[model samples]
Target: MADDHGTSIERARQGRMTSEQIRRRMFDAALATTGTRGMTLGFPGLQMDDVIAAAGVSKSSVYRLWKSRDAFIGELLNEAAATFADQLSDDRALRTAIEIVASRPDLHATADGRRRLILELIRVVLEQNYYSTIDSAAWQSFLATSAALLADDGSESLRRVAETLRRGSDRFVEAMASFHEAMGRLLGFKLRDDFAGGFTLYAVLGSAIVEGLAVRHLSNPAVTDNFYLGPPTLTDEPTEWAPSAIGFLAIYDAFLVVDPDFDPRTIDAYLKELATATGADSVPPADA
Candidate 1:
């Protein structure tokens, strides 16, 4: 009778679990396992057992949630973008996301790992040929939906929003590549070859630190020596203010004037300090 009661209790506990929580667990497991590098592989080394173990679910649960790996990855990526959009309006959320990417101490070593993750995700989405099984619309749909997050209205303004995010994410991605090239030139060596780290570290920190500090400079013109402040001083700039893409680009151009001997590294360090102040101090150096 006691044994029967324990079995019944276990069943009741399992029954009490919500589907959303269960799905979240599964999604998180997939993200962790696929990671940044694994994301790039043609077919990332994903395993049902591995995700199941990571998610703390039985094989049957995993199968029930996503019948196949392609379905699971597609769903997972779509869900992440959707969740990320939820934070789009909150100025703090975007800053926090970039900061979290930088604060890794091992930025140097894992740079490519991050890049591959990004490139792979984009590659599959951008090139339908990359994945034979997944629906191509899934990728485009995710992009469109996520882009709409920044706007007040929904897909009614999706075309405009999509264009903006695509342009921004592209410009942002290009700037990073140039940064890597510049570093390879500046350090008189390849950041990946000479520095202690890899590409993603360089990519994230190099681009972000500059952008972050540029925002600072735009706000507090006095905080700088080389760059021109836009209107308000950093002190006057609202911590809550959201800078537009052009606003950020102007600051980027300003940094060039501010430091005649400008290296993005200078901004990188300053942003690190600022991030610490903001209580988001997990940035890994681009060459870490």
Candidate 2:
């Protein structure tokens, strides 16, 4: 009969979705739900019925994939934590900052010029990171999960979360350290002898400042938008400096000192190499 044939076709279509496919759909739906509703300790707001509706999958399919709701949530959190490092390790902003420095050959000739270049790069990178962080729902959810886990008492889940956070933190620090090392080598600067932890500490502090500002910005956009007029430069009038820029510069000044042994002649070669590495086509020649 036609009715029987149609029912069989519908069943075949539903059967084509493998268990893995169903699980992936549920996972994506859960992340989207958490991102919109915000997560808390134990992910109390993440209901199975809600995820099932959003995923457009049957309750039977989801239940067949996991033993229970708690088991499903555990897997979801584990998967999220596993991906935390990759999600946070974006290098686009750093590459852009490098391009900005490479395009300004005139700034490399003088100590003051180089310092100004560094300041401008920091400001630009920080602003970019802030905007990127706030705009990403996944990043927001990760931050919230981290906060909740860190505030909880000792538990197996807390330990797992802490380890995951440490990995993400380490990746972020390494990215910043690479940025610092490259700038130091190119611009004739080095970590101060008295700075005990070197680039690692510097990276940690910088990340903390940006993360704190981002968290505050969620409640008050004005805090992130606030800027102050910096002192006049030799060739230009005063310019507006963001709060993060001022904070970062203060730390930069305290932690870094000019390298007395650096050779100015090698700057061109360094810039060329840097431009190639960052895939930048607009870097001006050293003489220009």
Candidate 3:
């Protein structure tokens, strides 16, 4: 009896450890799934079976852990929110520094920090397509889940889920809005000025950047070739994407062009800083 009890405890401990690892891998796999596949196809096309395969976990284990695909994704978003907390703190520091620059307009004292912050954000923009795409899916899912509650066949359980999703969507949007506002401030103006009908220029521009990259990356070679009328290639390497970054900088340049007082050199300096840090401006050697 004593031996059996000891054996049971050991098994239980191993089971617990396995469960913990499964949960962690599932979270990571969810991120991977959403990052590559979701960027191209969007979340609506995301299937649970593919997620299980990508995660390398059994469907039984996944269901035991998250109960359903939506529940798994919800937890993934929660994990992302927790991660964003750290980024939020960084944004706060950058915002405070930028506001100081705005008041005093000192390029030398604050330029390094500003450039570093822009590099951080630009890295996120380039590498983490999931950040923007997931928010869009979450918002859509929130509304759909909420609307389902009004149906005659609605269940109380689903309503609860919808409420949770609603809260998640709200937090996600708030975080994104804060980031957008910070970027706008860095540009020395609001992205959604009265002339723009209250629609955020940053959001539109960000979406365009994401879509363009996704097309170049996730689409068939023929599709890209059709657009370019030849073979088209786009690099995923962070260090080799200066041209794309330059394209983004041009939008900021246009904004600065309109403002006679705001110096374009400030932005040019920041882009140079980013290019140096990313090695995006490096030229390949000839006769390699």
Candidate 4:
């Protein structure tokens, strides 16, 4: 059987886009490449020839937009950062990042396909120093692309994103540590390091777990002492006690992409109540 990723990229050529359209096509190719290849050979080593081959674009055509392989790849990474900004209200980089994801041909390929692509994008952003290495022109292009994703979203959003991106490079290192720890816990493997590389680590961690999830990621991870971050542990079931589906409710409201009838404020209220009642820090564990 064809891997779901292969089928999707094969179908991307249906649209006969122009130079501008082809630029869009290249972004789609990047997403597809990551979806199929994973990170090791996927992110840093994805050469111009690979993109040209995958994008089915001539060298001349690709060159009209990017001067060299580094420029092309840098723009590609910027596009990803912009896509990631979508989940943040005041972030252009993030929104563009999402727009990039939403535009993927593989979006329709399979749920698993999309997830892998999203994860790959994150890994590249953080681990590969994808965003940091770009030149100013590419940075401008990245933000512009991100703005396109927002489509008339106010400028404030982009500024907010710049603020976030402006985070000290060192922060990325701490972030990488947290990411490795979290991934280690979830997957049953430990990262080779405690996430030592600073901004590169931030970009990687933020892209995969935080950026890919965008907002929906927090659905399960948002718990405070009372709020509920993970599965609730309960000890007694004398009467088969039931818990509220607070997490799902947020899924509905926060991501309108999910629920048509979602009401954000109500969901917030419910979360607040849950937090207060359970006491954020010491909710009884299972069997309590």
Candidate 5:
């Protein structure tokens, strides 16, 4: 039976399987393995034999696809980095933000209420983004690549990884800036006159805070649970505020202020437009 099974496997490989198909299978298997066991610096932990076994491909097939182990690892890292960036769920986050705004009509009536609403949105969104990152293995791998920049190795592989990371970072920052700008306009806020960096800078700072906290959380998960009671101005009752939320709020306040000319009556219309734009109306409830 074992001999028969081996023969069938060999027969399947010799059939019409394409090179791209084989490479994809091996790449996926390697990612799954890295996800479970965690990645090591320089990817030394991802053995070729393990990938072949997991992918159920012959050794010769893999070598035919990638001339050397280094070549395979380099391509894998590049692919992983690109996937991580491509997977950023800004639409989902925007949908959630729309819901937060739509659910609280009373909050839109007054300045304080509007301020509180923005704070709540920031806290919830920050937590949501942070948790999502920690849950994703591809994201963790991409993040790990950041450390590779610290090494003095100027190899072509490292340069590709760095370029991919930069592109991803730029894409993230741009997406975030757009999101923040929309939310700020919806809530009758504008960047302060004294704020020179504008929304782009806001996005950059916000990204740093979330990523910094995420790295810390990896080492001490207790950081997630570490929150202080909110002051009375921000919440009616004492609310637990994560450090990241606090930092974000501080940045938000510094960067934005209430737009005096904003008409509160237009808020509903604004939200409706935002919901339509983000396709949030079709999005199911968070609990659902």
Candidate 6:
């Protein structure tokens, strides 16, 4: 009966596995399957069997950790929120430091140079938002999940999903504000108060517009060629995209600048830096 006793021991050991460990395994599986056709193509469409197969875990294990598909998605949204929070924290510090450097007299000796530096900082902030949203699979999935919830307006889940998305967007704005505040400290001016227009509105809308362009460009390269100002050959890589993006950002900023004396074109010099970052030909030639 030794073999039977060993089988009983094995069963008992399996039963004794910790819930946290099981959850971790299931969470990893869900993340692994995120970019696959089933996950990204549609939201809340993935079946229990799909997760079970992808996770390599038994149905009972998944049930124990997440009772249903909705429960699993809820957990995923929480994880995405936590991840974005960490990313925002890191970006806030880095952007602040960059703004401080940009504001330094020695680095930006001319008024034009300073203005350009500030504009570049704005692009960086937008890119940070882009990374947090489009570049992140978890965030994208969470967005899709939230959209699905909103579509089902009659459901009780809509409120929770809406709140989650609203909170996430609010945090994103607050993070952007921190960068603006840091820049303001250096320039001795507040963005919203000093700019004459609603800094908050422009900042939020500009970021959203840029993000939409990025997404559309990815989905259809032809859209960039037909609509954007520069060469129709614009690629999504930051290097190939510098000129058009910088020009667009300048146009957007023009409305935000209340001072008749303020000229958004001062940022032309900084656009070259974007080119340099993308390993493209810098404007005015690097040596000159």
Residues 1-288 of candidate 6: C-alpha lDDT, one tens digit per residue:
999998788657656768776666666666566653323423345566876666555668668777778877766655544443334333543433343343343434345445544555555454455444555554555445544554665644456556666777777666655545445444333344445545455556555665565566567756533422232211223333332345446644555332334433433344344344445443442122
Alpha-carbon shift of residue 237 in model 3 (angstroms): 18
Model 3: per-residue Cα lDDT over 116-159, one tens digit each:
34444443353344233333533233333444445524544454
For each of the candidates, the C-alpha root-mean-square deviation to the true structure, in angstroms, is 18.6, 3.1, 11.7, 20.0, 3.8, 8.4
Number of the top TM-score candidate: 5
The TM-score values for the models, in the order shown, are 0.32, 0.83, 0.35, 0.30, 0.85, 0.59
Better of 1 and 6 by lDDT: 6
Please give, for residues 1-288, the per-residue lDDT of candidate 1 as tens digits: 999998788667655667787788887776565333223322256676777777765666667777887667656645544443332221243244334335442332333433322222222221222121122232333334453355544433344445544554554455445543433332222432234445544444434543344345436735422322233311234222122222333322332222123343543564465466557644555555
Q: Where does the lowest 10-residue lDDT sum fall in candidate 3?
A: 227-236
lDDT of 2 at 26: 89
lDDT preference between candidates 1 and 5, better one? 5
Predicted model with the maximum lDDT: 5
What's model 3's lDDT at 182?
46
lDDT of each residue in 205-230, candidate 5, tens digit only:
99888888888888897866487776
lDDT of 5: 0.78
As a whole number from 0 to 100, the lDDT of residue 74 in candidate 5 is 81
lDDT, each prediction: 0.43, 0.75, 0.45, 0.40, 0.78, 0.51
Order candidates by lDDT, high to low.
Answer: 5, 2, 6, 3, 1, 4
Measured on C-alpha atoms, candidate 3 has an lDDT of: 0.45
Clashing pairs in 3: none
Candidate 6: lDDT of 115?
A: 53
TM-score: model 5 vs. ground truth: 0.85
